[model samples]
Target chain A: MNLPPLVQGFVLHFGEMGSRWGLNRTLGQMYALLYVSPQPLNADEITEKLGISRSNVSMGLRELQAWRLVRLEHHPGDRREYFSAPQDVWAIFRTLAEERQRREIEPTLSMLRDALLETVETDEEKHAQARMGEMQALMEQLTTWFTEMNRLSPETLTRLMAMGSRVAKLLELKDRLRTRSG
Target chain B: MNLPPLVQGFVLHFGEMGSRWGLNRTLGQMYALLYVSPQPLNADEITEKLGISRSNVSMGLRELQAWRLVRLEHHPGDRREYFSAPQDVWAIFRTLAEERQRREIEPTLSMLRDALLETVETDEEKHAQARMGEMQALMEQLTTWFTEMNRLSPETLTRLMAMGSRVAKLLELKDRLRTRSG
Candidate 1:
């Protein structure tokens, strides 16, 4: 399978980054192909482009769909299912963040909570609980911030992002006003 | 090597999540052991506790040090090096986030930028460039926000996190006040 030089570069790079992002090489390559393609691609086309087997393509598509990173579509006259990445890159980023928080962060938070609830029979257990408590507090704070960010309209989110360090200035201003009024 | 049941549960959970977070099972287990241990542990103690070979422990410790998730210390009169996780969980979280952004996100952003710089000879290439542009913009915005957050003092970061959704309210308040006065 011969990919265009540009697409090939992206596909290969993503393949290498797959494991780092909690995905396999094939899934990363498949998502990269879909992202770069001008049009929705069918399973056979993806397999042909990536030089993978038909079943592998099917599995990869399923995984991508589960992550909500790809969408299923069909052309007017086509009976086969086709996949393409969301056009809005921000949407894709949010989806990835939410999924990772759910998969990785949430579980650890729960584990910490459970550990904290256990009775401390010794100083060692007390120390362990203290560590878990600190971790839990940090995770909870982060998750709360994430949830609030998720509530913002996309426009507002974009503006907030563009604000960047300006938020710090705003925060300082708020503190000054509060101090003066109080 | 036998671990306390509670510690074992936490260790196994982290070991399972290790690959998802770009670390291996051994690295996760070693970190978990260090995290829960009441005191710093030497390589020999870690090997005996985790039932891993000394060399495997060495490699995992090296990787953990590279991630900045583990610290080395020496007890008085003890020549063998000792390893422990940072007592400050937030500091550990920040280190992991910074390291991951440096290793994974920055490379992908650079790749996108390079792809966008190429001359487009075909409609497909043009479309690919458009997609890459969107991704690049999103990544740049995110990196900018991360950098700003990183610049914040730990106290300020904690306050901002604790503020959570209230920041949005503050933004709205500022907007309304400006509209009335300006």
Candidate 2:
């Protein structure tokens, strides 16, 4: 891409990080370009700037749409589609968390659930089932927490995060007050 | 592996999920085997069970050790190294979080810092820097929060997650009380 040096650096970094992030390099670069761009871009423009084939851009965009990381836009009187990332950073973060939960965590939880239902005939099976039960419990707790947090406004979430470790102290105070009342 | 059906199911599932979790199939299976094993196992046992080559087992163990997901053990009168996963699931979760933050998040934060330092001569560069700044700020806030959470005992951390969205209401209550007092 003929992006400004500052933007290019960030795009390149994301491209490099793509594999670790479970995205291909081209897709990562594609998303980065969209994320920093001031306006929505069409496939032709994206292909020209990033210097990749039109087919690859189309494929990457499709993958990004599936991930809900990119949005499709249509300009007035134009048949060609355009793409852009969500403008709000918090929204983007929330989208990513939700997507990962759905795509990765949910499947694993389902597998664990199915595994837990099977009859155990040996000590090894018993131990394995117990471990699976623990994992399922933890995942359930996390998903519950995630669902609750998902309902929170971005402002509220930000406040919660800013509280940092101070949250533990608050929990302690609340517990002591409860004990005294009882 | 000639593992019991129950144990084998879990191991095979993890092996399939390896790519999505930033691990290879064999490493995923290797860790899964150790995690559910009744006792610490030597390399030969792992090879025999997983039916992978000895070299692959050795390489996978070293990688797991590097990730701190597997521990090395020594038995009296035996020269071969034995390995096992931590029995505590909470410990495993914490170790994974810390490793990811170190390996992935920290580097991105560093790169953002460097990019922010450069002078911008155009509108596009300025806009890009602004976006980078936003991302950097969010990352810093998250890292701070994560660091604080990392300090908590497992009991405390579990309690916090259990708190879920309830924490937001508590925050609101505290804020209202402060306003009234002021």
Q: What does each candidate score in C-alpha RMSD?
A: 1.6, 1.2
Candidate 1 chain B lowest-lDDT run of ten: B1-10
Q: Considering every candidate listed, which one attains the maximal lDDT? A: 2
User: Per-residue lDDT for A131-162 in model 2, tens only?
Assistant: 88988998898899889888999888889888
* Cα TM-score per model: 0.96, 0.97
lDDT of 2 at A85: 90
Candidates, DockQ: 0.68, 0.80
Alpha-carbon deviation at A149 in model 2, angstroms = 1.1
List lDDT for all candidates, in order: 0.88, 0.89
Q: B85-124, model 2: which lDDT tens digit per residue?
A: 9988888888988998898789899999999999989887
Docking level of model 2: medium
Q: In order, what are the TM-scores of chain A for the candidates?
A: 0.95, 0.95
> In model 2, which residue pairs have backbone atoms overlapping below 3 Å?
none
Instruction: Indicate the DockQ of the complex predicted as candidate 2.
Output: 0.80
Model 2 regions lying over 4 Å from their true place: none
